[model samples]
Target: MKHGALLRKISVVGVSAACCIALVGCGGTNYGYTGGVAATVNGAEIQEDTITKYIQDFRTSSDLTSDDDWGNWMKENSFDPATVRDQVIDYYVENELKKQACDEKGITVEQSQVDDEINNMKANYDSDDAWKQALSSAGLTEDQYRESVEAGLLDEALEDAVAGDAATADDSKVLDMLNTYYTMFNGAKKSSHILFASGDTEKAQEVLDQINAGTLDFAEAAKQYSTDTASAADGGNVGWDAINSFVTDYTDALDGLSVGQVSGLVTSDYGIHIIKCTDEFTCDGKATSLSAYPQEFVDYISNIVKDQSKSTAYSNWFNDYKAQADIQNNDMPENVPYNLDMTKYDNSDSSSDNSDGSSNGASADTNADASATEDSSESSNEKSSDSENSGQ
Candidate 1:
């Protein structure tokens, strides 16, 4: 199982951008706050100061030097300053519950593990200054970052301990899953297609006619006329993806075809497609047997089964533990700094800037583990500068 899955509720930002700074002070013993408490998880106080610190650190790391920057960042991320305090508190509360559960199971993270995680994060940058800058950008001190890593490690250990037998599957289970999918999808099919622009039915029909007449080769027709450039370059091969992975129309057209059979002109949201079934895995309409499938396909299905087993195990364990835990959230304190008055910041100038402030597409509420590695060079900033640019 992925360690990130264990702490999804606690991670409030992407790793490359914020390094998951929200996780600070989430593990170890209680802070023993003398100030007002934000929450109480099984009689352990989550201090109001802790919530304030999280917001302050996030603000500092995001380089929100002015009210305008803060306001714009909030706007871009759809953050409601009024409820951010409650969100932070809730995340900490969940983290505390996980930590407590780990403790109950005698799960402990060694300091060396925390150090190694930090060292791995440091390796992602070139110099000490760059490392420090990343920490500051994440709004984390080295010590606080260590705490986050420790919490993540503890959560991972807890998952393994609790999941136990549910994390594995026998060969019988794998075959059963494959049989179900095969019966539902009428066995798997692989296809290649020649695509045309939407509404270009005349052009699509002409290409189909040429291929049907035996004058034009299917692969050559795809390479010459298909608009889906990525698949077209490879003779329009969509490969052996699961049936559900394709659009409804594509899958419907593919389902009716036998091996080496060419489909009539099919239309979907992606535009017109002339599909050819390259391969199939049906054992003469018998869904009970896998003898007809290649060993490679069986192996693929086995891995998927194992992954699903692990995920289901983790989910079941966490859900049960959380449901039984004594989690109590106190009301929000009146004087918390999270409630920012947007009226003070001039929105007219910064409203048009769609950048989420960070170079990566790190939002104030996204999942990232402490040990997560990401290439800083290739960020969402490079993919598309304008948030409105949703590429086809």
Candidate 2:
């Protein structure tokens, strides 16, 4: 899908930009009940109330006001409410796993950290009252919001531990990153074009003929006939970009073109286009060899590579943990999907079977182990400048 289409998919969560800075969620209706169990992780029950809060929070964030609204929204978005409910459950379950992992690793989130995080989040508002009002709109009390923040922090701590041991990048990984982001490996190209929708083939051909015959300037043709209005407005200048940014067909069409040379109609996923090669140059705007690039540039690329390595390290560690987690759906409502197993160890390790008899083996379960601890008053005071789930 086009980038514009993807924006619409997530536009309902208008708070995303703020959340990126504040780590606060949109909040939800007060989930009043407290006793029923939704699921158990490593023998510890995840309360139905907690699951309800997450579901409600998700709904509020998605701009769904009620269960009915959630159902209708699902239909319009081509999703099943049951599937969404399951996803919410999974999100909560992951939180539980993070808590468990932290415990095993003897990681305790400092209360001070949480307090700092909260203060920073509050700073995003005009005043404390404004922040509280925002929380209230999301159906959260000050206390409840704090709990989510702490949970988020704990998740982060676990992730940090995992990333600390991240593997160093291999040659293949470095090459992949260079191909996508840096133009030093190969010269970069800049160009502009008029994109015609797939169905407007005839119109595209007409415009192509005009440009070839000098009857119309490329920029004017693009501004007048291009369906991609955003690029058209800039006189079809897509700006300087990595050579690999374009699809194979588009790049293939540009082959053999000299500077200021316009190509014939080129087809891509977006539409048919006339490409004008404006410039090609080294990424650093210099003729330096890869070995002679400045130390700062090398360090910059190294840091980017390290960041990618850290993510991979954490994912590998987490997936292994999930493969052995012992999870049981205890009190999910009937008609909800009951297969709660998250591990890959099922059947292979008969010894890990749940005594509760819900299902046998890792295939029927997931695993993480920590003595579940209620967030204490001290831990609740800690916070971070990172995301709601940044710690994870």
Candidate 3:
């Protein structure tokens, strides 16, 4: 996904398309641009206006206006005008690439197949009217949402192109991806967090030390200085999640730790995290690992992982495509609002968390070093996992 996707931000938008369309569902008016073609793949020129509309629609739909927010988000995540433009070209190319792959292998998605998929989507909210209303409020037209859905379908088709061929070179990750949701959903995860806005390592470590020494009240300390306003105010509570979206460092620290165990600050592109083992919930009324859950949630986890695997595949495919395509960014900003340094991925107050369940930069991203700010309004999308790339 790191290489194939234009930027991980799109996955946030696209994630809504999959699990919760009402969340981070950006649908906006077209941004005008008749400056000719942006790039061409095998002589197929990508229309400048189409590319512009795509970017504008995403930006406008996301409701990102502030320079600091846009710069930080764009700089850190998987988005940039040129990067996105090339992604579109890769879509066109991959569509064709998959066509060749599928045709050579004789695989397909029929009208009825697509119809069933769309029906399942419509079933999520019941009635086209309700679905349309949700999309409308999110600033998207039926046409745009349909296209978004189609792209998702296309990504799936590419995967189905070689679903279970007898090749020794198997990507068990694909099976793992396909089955993640089903495994974890069956079991619920009862978890809690310790909020810390103090980017100071000493301060964060002190809080961890107190908790380990059985002195610091997890909820009390969170209320006092945790930057996470939302959780801090409400007891450092992050409701049940079938999958762990946190970085490896954070999860590894929590491994084998029993309920009531408090962890040390774990670092990531976002910032430091002090995860607490509150309680574990299960559909069967028993405790289990985060990796194992109920059948239904496990299925959900499967699709989540599947989509991510496909996303990664798509990214890799696109990068290879970009190498051959001639993309001249004649109008590229000399020193744009945010320098696209992969190193400067976090916001200015990245390490700040509070007991209030809100992060200092939760509502913003200012090109600093870390952040655990969750977007309450738009939190349902499948976040693009970071996989460091040589190119960016």
All candidates: TM-score: 0.50, 0.48, 0.40
Give one digit per residue, the lDDT tens place, for model 2 in 1-392: 22222122122222121111122232232356454666677876666665555545555555555444444444434345445445455655666677778889998889999898778667657777777776665555677667767766776687778786663555454444444555543455667778887788899888888888989999898789877676777677664433124566777766557679998878776677788887765553343344443333344445556655665678788888977999777545653322223233222333332367443211111122211111211122232112111101
lDDT leaderboard ranking:
1, 2, 3
Give model 1 RMSD, 1 decimal.
13.4
Q: Per-residue lDDT of 1-392 in model 1, one digit per residue for the tens?
A: 12232123234533222434645444434334324777778888777777766666667666664566667666666665656666677677767878788778788988888787778667657788877776664455677667767777787787778775665657776667666656533467778888888889999999899998999999898889988776777787766534225667888888899899999988887788899989875543344555556564566565556546655687777778778877776676555554566654445555526577433223564443232112111122223211111101
lDDT of 2 at 366: 17
If ranked by TM-score, best first, what sequence of candidates would result? 1, 2, 3
What tens digits encode model 3's per-residue C-alpha lDDT throughout 1-392?
22112122223322122112211112222334445555444454445555455544545555444455554555445555456445444444444444444455566556566566556556556567876775666565656555555555555566545432221222354344334323444444545665544366778888878877889888787777566666667566554444445545555665655677776676644455677777665344233343444343444444544444444555566467556654443343334322244444454445233357443222322231112112211123333212111000
What local lDDT does model 2 show for residue 226? 74
Pairing residues by index, what is the TM-score of model 2? 0.48
Superposed model 1: Cα runs more than 4 Å off: 1-19, 25-35, 63-79, 115-137, 170-304, 341-392
Task: Please give the TM-score that candidate 3 achieves against the real structure.
Answer: 0.40
**Alpha-carbon deviation at 325 in model 2, angstroms:** 1.7
Task: Pick the TM-score winner.
Answer: 1
